[model samples]
Target: MSDKFTLDKRLAAESVFAAALPLCDVRLMREQRWFWLLLVPRVKGAAEIFDLSAAQRAQSMEEINFAAKGLQRAAPCDKINIGALGNIVRQLHIHIIARIKGDAGWPGPVWGRGARQDLPPAGQAARLTAIQAALAAGVGGDMGPKLSNLLP
Candidate 1:
């Protein structure tokens, strides 16, 4: 495994890094209309989850679920949306979004609905702290022994 992992610039500009999981980096999207998180695997040249080995694939799923739980705990919503579309960024990243009934993009996808609004400094700090705490608390446990040996 490569120790040096580079994140795409568009991703970095869109979200804030919240925490480092066993196989991915947990990033919080800047849009305040919805609570969203991105799990970007720390693997080189990975544009999709299939690019990862079987073991890594399992680990990435676990990480994605973990981020979803964390986001749910931080913000309650009617539904949770998870996706991994690399059409623009071309990076292996999973998006976990908390959706509500009357949200800006309700009854539809959040992508390309409108421009994302930036969170204020205080709100950003609060969200970062909450997400960090949820991750540290292990919102969702590891993917068990079968996949244990896969992650370092």
Candidate 2:
């Protein structure tokens, strides 16, 4: 329900997956080392979550909770970390990441903690397919689009 807000100017340049809800936009992280959904409330002209009214804030939290549930079902992760770091994107987005103990960069924070291993073409395709299936079934809809499919 952020119908009154406007889209940010920088949104045009970001890597988008799909619009998951009325006020929620889901996008895949550029690096495919793991599955991470960047969910941002589509509030135009707002630099941060604090800029939203109380109602929008509550709604965003609800959407984020639902998105987290969706991610947990799709990823089947041991631990999930949710964060909204605006240092880089500055778009007031929240990241929900599925993590396992033995995953790449284990026992360490994913941000600037270790090098990311790029997913191979076949592996990436398979992972993406699995994630899509899980999201479709678990989340009751597709997590997002396959932006990688157009990279040929």
Candidate 3:
């Protein structure tokens, strides 16, 4: 992460703020029902994972898996969907989604399937607490650079 890094605007618009991980910014998508998280590496002008060095890529995967565990603890699901598709937001970022059997997009992809549901303030706060606790419990070594203003 560098002082020059700034999150992509599209990501800022769609995601609910979460913690900053070792190699990425952990975020919760605004859709309420599913546990969808996004991991954006803090590298300016990086549109692909390969843009990062070998060590950075390894660290990013570690952080992604760590976040997956936290997401699982927060909301258990039938499957965990992870991917990095830059068609929309070109910035190098990964999606870590916990999918249940009968979710909104259950048997289909969440993308372009439906509108994003807004979560209640209480629910959002609770989810955030659970995820943060889970990450804290599972993580080892330096937790990485944390942005004071995690929003956007």
Candidate 4:
């Protein structure tokens, strides 16, 4: 495995960078039907959660919870769904989605439900800003220089 971390091409194409956490690179999914975030560990060749060290796994869970809370604050929902299904992506990334009743894919998984509705440029910017702001405010101290700069 290479020491340097590189994001998967498919993930890069489908999401926008939101912030760089200590253990993960936070990204916002392009789908507009629900508020979704991807927490991708910066470890190269880490295809599954087990690939990470014990400390890394703990950090990943913390980051997941952090991102889920930020998502909830940004987009209030009835339920928050989290998953790490890598059947296709093969990347060590956790998905955190805010789900509401009667949404486009209600009572079912969001994957393969229908064609993804990509957010418009303006909507993307607005959602990213909301998420960044929510995360920044939720954290006690500065989220480091990288994350602070990403905040609006």
Candidate 5:
């Protein structure tokens, strides 16, 4: 297994690069239907959460929570769905999606529900800015020292 961390090709192609947190490299899903964020850990060959060390697990949870709150602030959604189903992309990454009552994949999983509505360049820029700002503000609370310095 490689020790150096590299992003999965599918993920890199499907999402827009965002900021890198202390433990994860944040990516914004290109689909505009839902405000989605992917938290991909920097650990090499980590296919599951258990693949991480105890410190890493704790940091991942904190980063997940931080990302969810930042998404909520940026998108103002009724529900925020979080999951780590590595069925297709066997990388240790968590999905944070903001959902409303009647979104495109409403009442169902966003995965393979319909064609992804790719965000226009302008829309992508706006969303990225909002998300970055919200994250930099540390929406919910203190994100701890490890993460606090990486934002913005």
Candidate 6:
């Protein structure tokens, strides 16, 4: 995003899961999984979710739901999970993840599993395109900025 979001160094240290889509207001970075997307809103000096104003909070919720819908279409997940477990990147953000049974670290939390399999370049772009197109056609939003392509 052009809105000058300095990546939280600690959060950046973790592997890039995926490139975010367009519905989210700020940078929605991926955390090295096909099932995971992290949405960090572009509010400066905001460390926690409570730092967001009530209006932004509501808008962010919409953004997150949009993400979930896009994910379900793109990945065909068994279930979708949304939350803000921001122990590292304290920015006011949320995560919308697609969960499936018997995939990777199945039936368990996807926090720390072994070295991650960063999606290959072609695959990443394809998935991003799917998500962006689905969100645009499904919800009528534009991804204002190109997602960072730092995979691998």
Q: What overall lDDT goes with each candidate model?
A: 0.82, 0.65, 0.79, 0.88, 0.88, 0.61
lDDT of 6 by residue, 113-144 (tens): 67667666666567666665555555423332
User: Cα miss at 33, model 6 (Å)?
Assistant: 4.5
Determine which window of 10 residues in candidate 4 has minimal summed lDDT: 138-147
**What TM-score should be assigned to candidate 1?**
0.88
lDDT, model 4, position 68:
86
Better of 3 and 4 by lDDT: 4
Model 5 accuracy (lDDT, Cα): 0.88
lDDT tens readout by residue for model 5, 27-106: 99998898899999999989999999999999899889888999999999889999999999998889999999998888
Stretches of candidate 2 exceeding 4 Å from the true structure = 1-14, 116-152
Which lDDT tens digits does candidate 4 get at residues 15-113? 999988889999999988888999999999999999999999998888888888888989889999999999899988899999999999998999999
Instruction: Name the top TM-score candidate.
Output: 5
Ranking by lDDT: 5, 4, 1, 3, 2, 6
lDDT of 6: 0.61
Q: Give residue 133's error in model 2 in angstroms.
A: 4.3
For this target, which candidate reaches the highest lDDT against the unseen true structure?
5
Residue runs of model 3 more than 4 Å from their true location after superposition: 1-3, 139-152
TM-scores of the candidates in the order shown:
0.88, 0.71, 0.86, 0.92, 0.92, 0.73
Cα lDDT for residue 74, candidate 6: 70
Winner on TM-score between 2 and 3 is: 3
Ranking by TM-score: 5, 4, 1, 3, 6, 2
Please state every model's RMSD to the true fold in angstroms: 4.4, 5.9, 3.8, 2.2, 1.9, 5.4
Residues 60-103 of candidate 2: C-alpha lDDT, one tens digit per residue: 78767766776788778888888887786676888888888987
